[model samples]
Target: RRTVRAIAVACMLTSATTAVGLASLVVSKTVMLRHFGLTSGLGVMVSYVVIITFVPAVLTWVTPPKREEVRRERTSMFTKVSNGLVARLLRWRWAVLVATDLFTVGAGYVASGITVDHALLDQFDETDPVYTTTLLIEEKLAGVRPLEVVLVSTEEDHFMDPEMVQTIQKIRNWAALRPEIIRTSSYGDMLRESYVLLSGDPSVRSENFKSAKQVKGLVTMMSQRDPSPLNDWLTQDGKKARVQFKLRDVGAQATMRFLDALEQEIESELGDDETVSVSFTGEAYTASRGQAAVVNDLLGSLLVAVVVIFLLLAFFFRSVRLGLLSIPPNLIPLVATMAYMVWREIPLNVSTVIIFSISLGLAVNGTIHVLARFREEMHTGIGREAALVRAARGTGRAIVISCVTLMAGFSVLLLSSFVPVRNFGELIAITIGGCLVATLLVLPPLLSVAGGDGGVRDSSD
Candidate 1:
């Protein structure tokens, strides 16, 4: 009965702590993450209700009391092993502390190397149809992605002004010459083709328009022809012109860099042109900005989660030291998971980055359960060492069982076809396993040494 009550209390506390971290993701700008956060938070609440209410009710109704006692005694081997391990750990607590510090330092070093990956193409396997099709398009057609440069004129038909036309032509020429650019097209191309046709000389180019009147005449003549495509490139008022730069399918970071450099060049070439201004918009630009937003949200969510969990622990235990002790066990799993990513050269993307908050929330469960049992044992008038051993024996098996169940649940994600989803599942499983080890092995000794009287009996007593 005592063990069952302790388990119920611990499970409820674990659910609350985990929900705090998951709830923080509700503020993310990404729609997918927002949905994930809400669903996961609800799932935690539902699981807690079921574990506390349904499981206990079923045990009470179906299982006889005498059989329950016999079953518990049959599990005595696990308790004995746990008690022996905790006894050994408490005796060598200093060595354990040193080893933990060294491991944490190494993990922290590796974690520092983790980087955000902005590439959309890298999300899938090379043999994926999307990947192969994109490659084929880059090789055969005008690239798969378009980087648009919109040139705005201060007045109507200003696109016909010789200086404006020259600036547009220069920008197009610059883009066309770049190896990364597969092709370039604009109203400038149409103007050049019309000029050659009108002059009856293939050598004549559109830049040959020496005066504003000539440029206007060329635009007027083209307007007479079917202008559906022309309307897309030029605004109805002729006040805006767009140059479409078809770029080879470069990854997100490289694409952003290219756009930045091109914008700078446009500024330098069209210096102080009060009549014209330029801006950029395209699929590549949107994706780059989205990646940045995700990174910011990830960092913010992590900070909020840590603060919330810390406060919750403090409030639950009514002891600041116990609350502080909760941090290292939870953090070890998160940091070690990131270190594993660094060692494996995995880039932190939209899906993988959320693992930090999720792991933090889940990892603290074992720590809370162990601490709750330790406090219960101390309240029975036992010495600190005996309480620690008893707590480990009574609670350690439950923590291990819970962690294994959670890991198995998350591990099912490995079957997902998406690489990010698979990686998320694998990393989360590792994180739960790491948390189990930290909670069972590392946390008990720390509590024995630092947690004086196990927060039950005062020193004056």
Candidate 2:
């Protein structure tokens, strides 16, 4: 029964953890979704996960319990590593390598905090014609973000008030100073521009044209090009008004900064007590702000998963030190990956934001397997250093196999047409690779010093 439980736990940790990372990759292929929409792209993702996760899991579950027999059948004297240069290093040289990895992981943590934004095709490519033309539109036309900010007030007369018109005009003036902002379009801007074009006509210059016929004629002229989705921005009762601004490009950090500033100004100007408040939607700039919220949610999900992992580890071992040792290795890979992005100038987009959340689970798998084996060896009365070697030799094959499978699965995303999704996959694969190398090489040595049998307590306990 104990043997079966161990096998089941091992299989679940390896398979399910890898599945989470692959799912992040699957959901993030933006080009597929962008080109085909949700129905087709989402269907492909669901099918892909099912095949990858279930097929291997079912095969592992049904396989006969003759791992020892298979091991004996496969081994020859050459497989023993009795006396080569490689064997000599395995015995004495791993300490230096482990120290270097630890240093890299530590330095990486410090570097990830300095955030940078991506350029228009930084998520795509300037070499691609579609992306190039898109860049041209952003650079030449100065309109990229497609966000609209609507100001709504409860009193019908409030929207037509001269004060309200002046407020929107001020906001537009404030927005125009930022480089990432293309332009701000409001009825007030239209009024002023049109009034100038109409040879300074007093009738056209009236801030609140209460006459329905005059307002209708003005609306018709503005609707000629309708650059800002003006119809949708209007309130149902005609008591609300909207201002629209397009970003210089999607995923621009400058645009996000500008929107946040504009939102704050609107809130401060109107105050919460008044019925006047600004609401936002309908542009890539809005979606970029949404990405910040998504990052917050992903962090929350990670915290929940960490709680679950601690409970599961405590339940399995009834020990604290082993569980505590497991935590650092799981976390470092994510920090390292983010650091790589910072160094390489990758922006935090929707797809890239979720990588660490998913990678956390995958990084834990090899640590679990390694720790499990080390504890088992200690129970059999092996010395700490000898036990480390036995643990590595025993579980190394399984850990390497799982890592390879995960790397291959994530590598499939390199074929994606979306540059951001493709970069995300490749970076995640690199992180998983680092984790695998950390577990098989660095961790075994660390545990020799750290995982003292029955001496270290679980941090949670």
Candidate 3:
């Protein structure tokens, strides 16, 4: 009864901590992160309710006190293996510590190289229909991604003014020089083409418009066509005009760089001439802004989760040392996960970066259970070494069971058609397994060496 009670309490507390950590991600600016956070946080709570409510009830209904005692006395294969492993780990504690430190440093180095990528292309397989269709469109016609440049005239009818039209033509000519811009459509293009056709003179192009009245007449004539394309580019009041640039399928970072250069060029061209002002908007710009938001939220949420969890652990155990001890084991898995991403060239997108905080929350579950059991044993007058071994035999098996269940649950994501979802599943599985090894092999030895008198005290006492 005491054993079951301890496991139940520890499980509830651990689940609560993990839920809190995941719930924090709901505050993220990215829609995907917000969804992931809410779903994962709810999952933690549901799992706790199911485990704490159902498992014990089922156990009590089936197994009588005598049968439970007999079951406890009969050591399972997992218990035997865990006990042996703990014994061996204690003997080689110093060597294990050295290896752990080396692994952490190496993993941290690799993790530092992980970059954020939020490109839509990165989320799909190259052979996917969407990808192939985009490529085909870029080849045959204009690129799918539009970069809309809005030119606002200072005066009401200034859109037709010769100077404003000239400035727009100059901007288009500048854009034409860039190979990244596959196609550009503007009122300037229409007017220049019309001039060439009507005047029967190729030389009398865009700048040849004599005045605002001539430009306005040309615009009215163009608008009378069966389907006027000018309506899309020019506002009803003629105060605002749009230049749509159809870009080749450049990746996210390249697109952002291109936008930056294009903005600088626009400023240089029109900064001195106050005829019009330019602003940028489009799919590419929105994506760039979303990527930046995700990165900022990732850093902020991760910091908050770590600090909150550490303080919670300290409060739960009534010992700051035990809380501190829990950190390395949890952090090692996070660093190792990021290192794996770096090696695999998987950029930390909206989906992958959240794994760090999620994994930290998960990795600490086993540590908390093991530490709780160890403290219980110490309270019963057992020495540190004996308590660690017993804790390994008892709570260690529970950790393995929980981890296997979690891995199984996460493995479902592998079947997802989305690349990010699949990567997230694989990385999470690796993180769970890594945290288990650290908890079972690394954490016990750490406690024995650093926790001289077994630095944990049960807060309940």
Candidate 4:
């Protein structure tokens, strides 16, 4: 009952912050992400209720450990580390604070360099069979990634015109020269092959035909009753034609570069022509487009989480400084996660960017627990230093135990076959470890120097 009473509010507040982070996913442009946010957010709150209510009910029947045993557990650690350790550290609190500021500056700089992109096969490592087979298929046969190029003309049989055919040839010829494109196919190639086969004259050339009439003559010679593969590339009336560009499965950087270059090429090739406009659609292209959306949506989600949490902290403690102080414990962990991404070569893609909000939501729990305990201790009229020391020593063990449990839980995901899942696990563990250190060591000196002597009494009175 004593334990539950002491920690219940902090646990509930932690759940609220975590739920806010998870629930902010509704703003995501992706449906899967939205659903995930709703369910996970709801789950966190439900778990909080269960922990506070159900655990207390069960504890009522269980006998507590004797007071002496508890005292021994607490005082034993004090003897070695010494209770004056916190006060001793505060004598040079200025140095500790300065070092923390320097670390933050470096973390911010490293975080700024993260790049974003997305890919399907990226979920698996290069050594995985799926990844290796994909590469082999692309190298041996052709690019498994298909980019569809469709040309629409308002006029009937527009693609049959020799001029349109020449335009198609220009695109194919351009693609052929690009190393990224494994192969290109279109109705123009088909018509040229048919024109030669039917003419039975090697001298007759496809590019030589200068008018729609000449191309139409070749098409007319083929029996309507016979099915031709060219029909699939062209509509019944030939208003639209399809050109397939099979491209190699280049990595994210190269793939995005190629897409940008293609966009420019299409604009330059068909400039000022009202009759034709180009757009891209395919899994590979869609993934590239979604990268921008991921960055925008996830960044917005992170903002929502931070704003909501700051407001909550400010309201709960009734001290804006405390709320503001809560930020570094969370921010340092977030920056550490970004640095982890950079160090590990993990791109800030769809699977990994959400770590910022999730880890931030988590990192605040220890800070809140410590501060909340400090408030409880201050109410007894102890000096600020005595209260902070009491709070840190009192809550420190529970925080360590909780952080260890969470770290163990996150580390389990390392065994996942998906690279993103594994990276997520690894990053979350690193972040929580940072948060543990920040909350225990860094937050103490901060509270001592900047938190003021009267605590909330200074503001409240």
Candidate 1: residue 402 Cα off by (Å): 1.9
TM-score of 1: 0.90
TM-score of 4: 0.92
Model 2 segments more than 4 A misplaced: 1-9, 13-105, 114-120, 136-144, 154-156, 159-167, 189-238, 250-252, 263-276, 454-461
Native-referenced Cα lDDT, model 4: 0.80
Task: Give the lDDT of residue 14 in candidate 4.
Answer: 90
lDDT of 2 at 165: 65
Which RMSD values do the candidates have, in order? 2.8, 7.2, 3.0, 2.4
lDDT (C-alpha, whole model) for all candidates? 0.81, 0.64, 0.82, 0.80
Q: Candidate 1 vs candidate 3: which has greater TM-score?
A: 1
- What TM-score goes with each of the models? 0.90, 0.71, 0.89, 0.92
Residue-wise lDDT of candidate 2 within 5-38, one digit each (tens)?
Answer: 5555555554444444333333333444233323
Model 3 residue 60 CA deviation (Å) reads: 2.2
Q: Rank the models by TM-score, top first.
A: 4, 1, 3, 2
* lDDT agreement of model 1 with the native: 0.81
Deviation from native of the Cα of residue 324 in model 4, angstroms: 1.4
Q: Across residues 1-461, which tens digit of lDDT does each residue of candidate 1 receive?
A: 75476567677788998998798798888777888888999899998887777777677777566887877864688877887799899999989988999999999999999877656566677888877787888889976677788889788988877777777788888878887789888887887787888888887773457887887777777677775547778765779999898877666667777888898889888898787888888876777656767887887898889889888877777667888898888888888998999988787777788888888898888899878878888889888898888778777777898899999999999888677888989998999899999998899889977987665653224
